[model samples]
Target: MAKTVVQEFTKGLWAEIPPFRLVLGLCPTLAVTKSVDGGIGMGIATTFVLVCSNILISLLRNVIPKQVRIACFIVIIATFVTVVELLMQAFTYALFLQLGIFIPLIVVNCILLGRAEAFAFKNKLISSLADGLGIGIGYTLALAALAALREILGNGTFYNIPIFGPSFQPFTFMVQAPGAFICLGLMLAGMNMLGKK
Candidate 1:
């Protein structure tokens, strides 16, 4: 049982990473990754929602009727998303502004729904918790890596702190919408290559 739980937890880190492996949760992954701050903020908020919703869904799995399970799952996820949004608005208002609509859209993030239905709904509380945390952290790492790449190449900064000298030139395009797509594609391809080896 312990080994199984560990496997469940570790799988999210590599085997089922949301963006690279599962190709899930692309909206915020692409939109908010323009900066490390935005990426980390969005990642943490989504992580909170994922952990809370997963726990609740696992606890209520048996009670949720099969006919309306999907609706019930949404309600659970939306509740946590609202909590995260309000908390961010009160404490991290700047990041709140940065994330904007993406924060609210967490309710519909396929990762939450997918985990709720696929893992949490069928697992024990502890297993569900592990799964959520693992996946949440994995997602966070991915966003940070991508954001770091975009921020450094496009803005010539790391976490808004200048890293390069005056002689350095920023590739401004790396921070644009097109850059997000290209970067994601590159990362996905890299993951596949590594997977094969």
Candidate 2:
């Protein structure tokens, strides 16, 4: 009846996916998903912060006082978020520009702090690693799926490759804010459908 380390990891992929299955971290998810590249960029950046913060928090769990633990977690999470921002700026400047402020804003993402307080603070090193990775990948996949749909519908392109023929008309609105909300809503509905099956 005990869960394996792999189960702890894999659960984040579908069972407890954030911004969708778990309904956590919707801000950046909707903010940067206009294009597959930007969405993936934000996803990886968040994943980096998530995994690094989770590992560090798990390691320091016993050392941190319960009263001040949230502050410590934020400091730790912010440190990694800064690292991700710098790496994105240096290595992926274009995607960096596309994502803009959302990169640094990852520090406030609830999913990172939620995992730190709820899971990493109480779990072992490997289990925390799996949980972070699973959650990160789940978030990345969700962003990529949404971005793909938005790009294809709004721009008639997949990663700017032009998926639909020239005759296809792009629904430019699909890449806008209203489109983000609509896409997110539809995606959640799809997840619900899948969950019911």
Candidate 3:
């Protein structure tokens, strides 16, 4: 029993990382990763929804009809996403504005739906919660890594903290839309290589 639980928990970290391995939440992954702060905010918001929806879905798995499972999961996930959006607006208005549409877009993030259908619906509550946490953290870390690279090169700063001397020239392109594709492709390639080794 313990071993099964451990496997379930760890599977999400690398074996099924929502962004890197599964590629389920690319919209937010690519959209909100312009800055470390934005990536972290998006990660936390998604994590909240993932964890809440997973637990709820797991608990109601037996009751929700097979045909309506997707609909039910969406409603649950949307509720939590809305809560996170409102909280961000109330406490971090500037950040919220920066995130804009991507904040609400969490409702449709495939990671949440995939987990609800694939893992949460079949697993126990504890195991589902563990999966949610592992996947959420994995996604968050990937976004943070990408954001760190972009911020450092594009702005000569790391998470708003200056790391280079004033004489250093910043790569203005690193923060642009094209930069997102470049960084994500490189990061995904690196992750795949590392996984093989």
Residue-level lDDT of model 3, residues 73-177, one tens digit each, is 999999999899889989999999989999888888888999899999999899999889888888888888889999899899988999999999998888988
Write one digit per residue (lDDT tens) for candidate 2, span 46-120. Answer: 888999999999999899999999999999999998888888788888888888888888989999999999999
RMSD of each: 0.6, 1.3, 1.1
Model 1 regions more than 4 Å off = none
**Per-prediction TM-score:** 0.99, 0.97, 0.96
lDDT tens string, model 1, 1-197? Answer: 99988998899899999999999999999999999999999999988999999999999999999999999999999999999999999999999999999999999999999999999999999999999999999999999999999999999999999999999999999999999999999999999999999
Winner on lDDT (2 vs 3) = 2
TM-score of 1: 0.99
Backbone clashes in each candidate structure, one number apiece?
0, 1, 0
lDDT of 2: 0.91
In lDDT terms, which candidate is top?
1
Candidate 3, backbone clash total:
0
